[model samples]
Target chain A: MMPEKVTIADVARRANVSRQTVSNVLNSPDLVREETRERVRQAVEELGYRVNQAARRMRTGRSRLLAVRIEQTQDGMNVFDRFLHGLTESAAKAGYRVILYSADDDRSEIATFDDLLGAYEPDAFVLTGTHYGDVRTSWLAERGLAFVTFGRPWGMPEGGDHPWVDVDGAAGTAAATRHLLDAGHRRIGFIGWPEGSGVGDDRRSGWVRALGEDAEDSEAGVLERRTDGSAAEGEAAARELIAAGATALVCVSDSVALGAMQAGPVPVIGFDDTPVAAAIGLTSLSQPLSEAAVRCVRVLTRLLEDDSPDKPDHVLLRPSLVIRRTA
Target chain B: MMPEKVTIADVARRANVSRQTVSNVLNSPDLVREETRERVRQAVEELGYRVNQAARRMRTGRSRLLAVRIEQTQDGMNVFDRFLHGLTESAAKAGYRVILYSADDDRSEIATFDDLLGAYEPDAFVLTGTHYGDVRTSWLAERGLAFVTFGRPWGMPEGGDHPWVDVDGAAGTAAATRHLLDAGHRRIGFIGWPEGSGVGDDRRSGWVRALGEDAEDSEAGVLERRTDGSAAEGEAAARELIAAGATALVCVSDSVALGAMQAGPVPVIGFDDTPVAAAIGLTSLSQPLSEAAVRCVRVLTRLLEDDSPDKPDHVLLRPSLVIRRTA
Candidate 1:
């Protein structure tokens, strides 16, 4: 037989507190005194009291659901899935639920955001693949919604206090460059996205910083930025770099690195130590995406639960470089 | 300024039908006559009437939502993600919403299914990672739930009528074997999972069928079956096969193939041409996961909208072999 369902009233009676007080302790602990909150929590756990999700939702007028907005450009891209796994695992641990929202290219970002907000009224929002001057972020900020973005904010102030978690692209690239440099590679070529993009720029800066001004200015350390994020671009960049006598190439992404490898036998390194990177033995950086995703969810949930509008928290995580045969 | 909100009453009045009829036309077309449904649909498009999701949800006992049940064990695995992306995309195109329900291994599957069904009362359901003698499928069938699964029913009669979309695993493995044979590999090795599992056994059968009975029995064609699905197990199998004088190895999955590749320089082929397989240049049979997922959602949605329990439709997509350096 199934175990009997436990209710909050059981704990409230045991703790000698009103049902409302028990509710306050669970929903908004800030409203209750620390000692009272501790007593209620202990009683609840002791009684195995589970808050009735439906009743709680009705009382608070807020669903314990968070929205994860993903772009639906590519039909079968699994990159978002990896991040989602991390987010779901973390959210489950914290007793939160995730609802997926797909952003279509044809729809205005604001329209999409409004549709989701109106339909779900999600407690908090997590966004991915945001671009420069994204209206969605600004709108959420203006509405005082608790939210966090996975990518670095574009056009935002440097070191801006915004709730976000991203791969340390610059640092990862620097480590990649240092690895090649230590491997007796002086003529290292860089294949990256066009300048002015947040991730592309960050990775490019890391390469330049590691190489120094002398190498940056010299023909030995040429940087070729791709106009688009595609393997074809990487192949072209590799051909040019090879013609320019580059012994080693560092690509901005695993796909690009793979393309460069396919174009020629020149040893190449890539970012995002994606599954492909590991399979091909391409020396690359593995971003701690799952960890970052978990952290983002945790921080955002805390903000939503506390209703804290305090200074935003920004987290930076170090990405590890996996050495493969490519470089 | 945003356009004035269009109401359902306006559409109903314009179509000269009762508001409830209009609602039925939108939500359950099977309940409305074809002529009346066309008139209501035309009125809706004319007025640009988009359902006020929150308002409609409040008025109706049902939600315009469906739940995709995913096992927690397969959370980070990319294979599930590919199917999810396809399912989500197709569901969105049909103006339906999907919520993910993570199933806990510790909980009784029936209890978990009951909880989700009672809470969400979703219009339809999609189950992932279904196995032989799946109690959930039988229970759902008994309850007459509009549901679909990812694979053919195991422990059930052949040609069992069910709404499902499955990849041609046997044909895919045969193609992989033929590719290696065409590449001048006469002494080939086969590494697969234990013979009872549906997917693993199908792949192994295909490999055996591709190599005639005489060739299959010969010392040149070695077969190694591992009870566990792990890289270490695959590596061990590969080592044994290599010692037996095999030149090429075909694995049941990409992970197993990658593991076998790590054992030595023997050409390795895998199934499910996953992202990892693509990354490492492992020649594999690429299952049409996204298409299968989309089709599953489409079929399940049809089942929900159509009140009559029509004969189940089955879709089996042919898997394509991806040629890479490994083969």
Candidate 2:
């Protein structure tokens, strides 16, 4: 059975310290002496002192809990899986736990956000896969809730007062294309998803940027192909690109590269550097997911703590090429 | 700023109803008159009524938060992602929120459980990937915590008190083997993980079981090969199995099946029917993960509700084969 509420004064008395020391121990442990911190902690534990969340909130106006939406793509790409793991590890180090929810779409996501806020009382939200004029950010921003996005607010200029972390897809694809170009391949084709997605287009741009300033046939979208981002479709697209005088290929996703690999042993580079690519020895670009996640949490904790005046608002991390047998 | 929590008494006074009626409206609306329920709900909404969790826990002991460990395999298998989605959906229906944590190993997982119990005060936990003499379960059991496993407690007897929902791996592999047998293939081979894991061995046993009940060469691991459950390793082992008279193969995982498919297009069946499997058209057994997740929550809720004596403590649901191009 839980005992009566053990106040900070009680823990302080038990530890033979001032109440402020106990407060510092709980709120900012680094501010307290190590020995005094241990003593206060032992006293708190022995006395079963638990934070009355409401009381603590009213006093310090600070807390730590983040709500994360866990999503899996229809094609079974585990892109978010690695991201979730990285975020969780980083969040734990920062004294936060993630309350996860899944929603069918953005509308339901806002609804779930409302439910989670009321039910779990998370201090902030970590939005993933953000897009242009994203409703979720606007919803939270309108309510004056603290939050950060793991994806760039597409079409929003740098330093738009929105906090986000994103991997530079164009840089990743450009690096991939450059690797192929350095290997003496002139006609490097790009395979990507339908042109509507900002991420897909970003990746396509890098491939074009890597080709010389000729930008002629490449400008015609000459050797480029788009698909629904399936391995089978990738195979077909790869075949078509190969037929059109392309000796090397750059794909927006590992799934397409997988299909492209089946099309021929011709050198190919895939994005995301997923486990599937590694297992099959495919050259690909590895997203800096872990670093990005760490930065996301860093930006978020900075906001919740409100200690820094010039808190970093946006992060665009570069992905690196993992040279393997395929390219 | 959050105001003081609006209690049931406050809502009752606002609604001009008895406190008992207000409690009934909150806990069991079915027991309250419709008109009375509407009045109490409206009053509660007007007052922004928020239950004092600690006080409510003392009175009813029927809280609803389930702690789930979010896990991602090193192989990029998203099996747990689907299971988590199913559990979240089902848990939401039952007014439960899942608090997710990820751990590196069983030891860290136990530490996370202790931390979660202290911080979240969840009513129960949903454990996945149970193994023989699992330390995690023993720790929970020792602490008298309520939990249900998504995996079976290996080596436990049929009527063991542990609550779990597990897909019948043996039956699943047996069905795959039988499908091949019905197609008139003899000397079918089995590819699985290096023989120690309970799940891997369970799948291997299914193939052995469906081998005409000969129980001779099958017992000797003849026509059977083991690998590290990777596609590259699977390919190498498949080649060996094919060389030694295996007309068809049953793989323990989709990754292995992906490898075996590269081994000369031999008829093959994989387990877990992952997204990769669907993308590549690998015939595989689909574990009824959603059904199992739903059942795990059901068992947990039943135990927590404690009104039903006939609680389904142990459940073994059979996995179904999804036929595709590979087979």
Candidate 3:
């Protein structure tokens, strides 16, 4: 059960004034006579009249609420928290508030969007964790809804105009690979997610680009294994790679690198440089998620306000390798 | 460069009707005749009229927004994310939306609360991560704001009426200690934050309660070391406790337990059972945070609606010990 909402009419009736007078008192208090203002204020206090945002939106046309979907992950190492921090901070700087919507999967996410649009009508939305065949992108795009994603539309046809800003996964692995190569470890092994994972494949391509054809052929020279990015899985994969004569490891995530640490003294490099990496002193690549979040908000703001000097449809940012004791 | 808001008057003028008729078209469309409805709909489409929540709030007092503060931690292993997940899921089930406010410290947080109250006027607030000497509690309480905290108002004087839901931290460590004891471990050590940390002291008390006074007297028998709960610091403290003849360890957090893991395989227990714990297979205590979140939202909803059966001022929850390979 909810409280009884005391509307402006209630305040007006209590103050013995017209509804327009009460509206003027709220929107432009100075425009009303001092005695009228005092009477309206007293009535509001007596009735506990709080301005309803639904009524306010009918006049202002702006909810001033930015909606962002957060998908809960089994792994607590999710970077969305940082991304959210960046988004809220930036949104607040622009005089907008953020609404957090939780959707476990695509269907629920579409429902969330529908519910938000029908009820709250957020000014705009920011999407995260986009992948190939992500239907959410198309859902918003078809509706002509203003939104910006933290990940690029991976499988979209070239020159599609959906706005997005993404950290270059390949660039991250390429940097890690080059770092390992520069360390004079030619027999480098890579641990990542199973193939066909868009992000994972991009990261693997970076390693192959660094190691040449030998890194491509599973039987030729590249020592590679894929798992679910768990520490135990990483350990098992690392042992196999080590037995195959790899002197260094390049993992897709800090979780895998942590597992690889158990496979001997071979140096390992990881991506995402999550808190786990800091705990164990593992060298890892840190995605510029905060910067990417800022970028996404900027693009969304532009799409919402339509006053920016220039709008970019997509942006790809490079990740920075944070060297620690691991590599 | 915001778009100009199309008003009810504009729609009415275009439809050659009174503003009240336009309102009727929106709120009670059935009251309008079919031809008038078609005319109003055409005017609305021609004018691109969107509902203004500000105007609607004057007629119906509901924003349906719940504000929650999210402080950005240095580490991505932020517990607030999990808390948000639970809060949003439950709030949505109740047909409410959540607004995320990001602030660095108490001052900014209070300012954020002020801004939101003046602007959107959310129905209620769910406070998380309360600390010693927190001023937000008093601030909100003094203003008679409808809110509930995720942490108990520790150190508050008797009969504090503000609602709060907190996990019994001592229960978590006590369970861990009892489990370790059952595993035939007599000499157990404690790794926690520095003295005077309310949560840390509570957890340490659980260990002392189980092990007796000798466990409280560092100079006599108990082996304890305090640090900033970093992996490196955990490693140093763990090594010292191990050198002092302790065979098992209970840490304040999973991060510390991770550092403790580096000090040899002595079966360390951690708090928070974070993703890192699952990845590394460290046995840890799992706070029923999701349940706690649901309870907090339920209480806050009651406070806001002012209609619930016998609302309590404080609710304490129990945590469970998750046994993993590390222990």
Candidate 4:
């Protein structure tokens, strides 16, 4: 049989201190006198107090739990591994444990959410690789659950109140384009994801915005646009771009960049300085995944601690350019 | 209070079947009639009669648990992730769970082993990246515990009795060398980990064996050899090789290959077609990690079920070559 859960009141009684002192010791250790904190800590250890996590959460009206829901789609593959590494490292340092959950392909969006809610009852959720018209976000929002997503939600106002952290997709692409332009390459081509895909669309916008009329008129400028994020598709896109007379190519991802390099001899740049990009010497933008993960944990922890449902916070991280032999 | 564990007898009584029939349904479903199996399964579900895993293990002298220990060193980084993924996937497919334990440092090795033994009482242990004088392997052998290691133990005989599954490190290196040879490259150089490193030594031996003694001794044929696995170290190694007139480079890992690529225009080939390798298009040898994981589970399971220590089994899987542009 499970042992009885030790409570804050029990600890306070044992330490001959008020419950508020125990609370202060738990939430803000600095505020409590060192002697008082030590006494309470001793009492906690002696009484085997474990803070009754669920009960404490109920009283604070916030959970200490954070749920990261990862979609198992093909495009979502490989990205999660790096993300997981970053998230796990950051979360561990911040004293938060992330519960990983995957959405079943056969389950409806709401059903998936329901199952997760029942299983974990996390305080807040992090939705990675969110798509257009994502129902998961709306369901959580309606239930008044604090949450954040990696990408902007569909139909949400540009400056709307909802916490999110995403890469400046357009700015990253523009940086890549400017790098090529600075290299004296005028006939630069863009091999990117298909139109209507949120992140892809943002990347294309950056390229188009950078090149302006040069991007608009020539069929040669748009080398290949694929809806998929596979190596085979990237290779096909590279071949098409090379045939169209592109002296240099800007790929949507490092994987695509590798494929492009294998497909032809044309110089290429890629996004997301994945280890592969560094390995192959592909000039690309390296996303600060570790920093973003730390920030995500910080923000989520704050929301879980405080009961206010004020304006949501949005964080946009800068992508650094890594120059290599490919470009 | 925790609910009382439902026993096989209770399940059998509810399903109107003998306890032996219930045991057959749980252990070997094929032995029971389909209708009887269905009835027993339904009874199990209704009563929530989970097999008393700990008790069953103790009675049968089979924990059905596979324990893997990884070396805790900077060079051993990333080994755990791949190994865990493979082991977990294989264990789940075979209706078992893998209990993971890690040695934080050399001092914790014995403590880690003790904790794992007491807590899980694993059926078999898999030791990866073991070094000279590894006490863990010898301890398990002395205790008469079934076990395996990725590489042969340092003090053990070449064709020893202990079961092990290993990548043909020599053959993989030879294959990489042959790829460079077939590409009409004679002035090839080797960049690898330090001599004492078992994997490094094995791979370097293959490179030397493939090129012949006289060719390997030539100044142009021997570029640079480094001890570290960091990208910076790789870059420095590559620069040294380039200065020594080495045209093509073979590296110990994808990270080194990436580092070498970042340093200059030299084409690089590496071992382990990790995700990063795929992203960078570095020609690499892809170790059969998933296959080896499955095989480990299969072997461990067989050993657990057979309940005999008469003989040990050893398996070796050949690594495959993945050709990319770096070569």
Q: List candidate 2 segments past 4 Å from native.
A: A1-24, A28-38, A44-63, A157-160, A212-220, A308-312, B1-21, B30-34, B44-63, B157-160, B213-220, B308-312
TM-score of each: 0.79, 0.89, 0.81, 0.64
lDDT of 2 by residue, B35-119 (tens): 9899999998998776654455435443467888878568775488888878888888887877778888899998887666555
Per-residue alpha-carbon lDDT of model 3 for B185-304, expressed as tens digits? 878999999887788888888887777633443442358889998878998999999999889999998888888999998989999887778777889888887898888877877766
Q: How many residue pairs clash in each candidate?
A: 1, 0, 16, 1
* TM-score between model 3 and native: 0.81
Q: Give the winner by TM-score.
A: 2
Q: What share of the true interface contacts does each candidate keep?
A: 0.18, 0.25, 0.50, 0.07
List each candidate's DockQ score: 0.24, 0.37, 0.29, 0.09
Q: What is the interface RMSD of candidate 3, in Å?
A: 6.2
Task: State which candidate, 1 or 2, has the greater TM-score.
Answer: 2
Query: Residue A165 lDDT in model 2?
Result: 90
> Using lDDT as the measure, what is the rank order of every candidate, best first?
2, 3, 1, 4
Chain A TM value for model 1: 0.83
Best by DockQ: 2
Clashing pairs in 2: none
* RMSD to truth, every model: 5.5, 3.6, 7.7, 8.2
Clashing pairs in 4: A279-B258
Q: What tens digits encode model 1's per-residue C-alpha lDDT throughout A157-274? A: 5533468877788898888888888888878888988777888888887887788833534553445656476777788888888888788888888888877997788779888766
lDDT of 4 by residue, B15-58 (tens): 99999999999889999999999999999888877664444654
Question: Residue B301 in model 4: shift from native, Å?
Answer: 7.1
Per-residue lDDT over B1-327 for candidate 1, one digit per residue giving the tens place of the 0 to 100 score: 333556789999999999999999987899999999999999988887777654565455345566775444331224776667677777777777676666565246566566554444466778766667677777777776678888877667554456878888888877777777887787778898876788888778777777763354455334555647666788899999888878888889887887898889998988887777766667888888779977887787678666655679788898998889887
A87-172: candidate 4 lDDT, tens digit per residue: 65565455444544444542454664554454234567777876666666766776777788877664665533577888888888
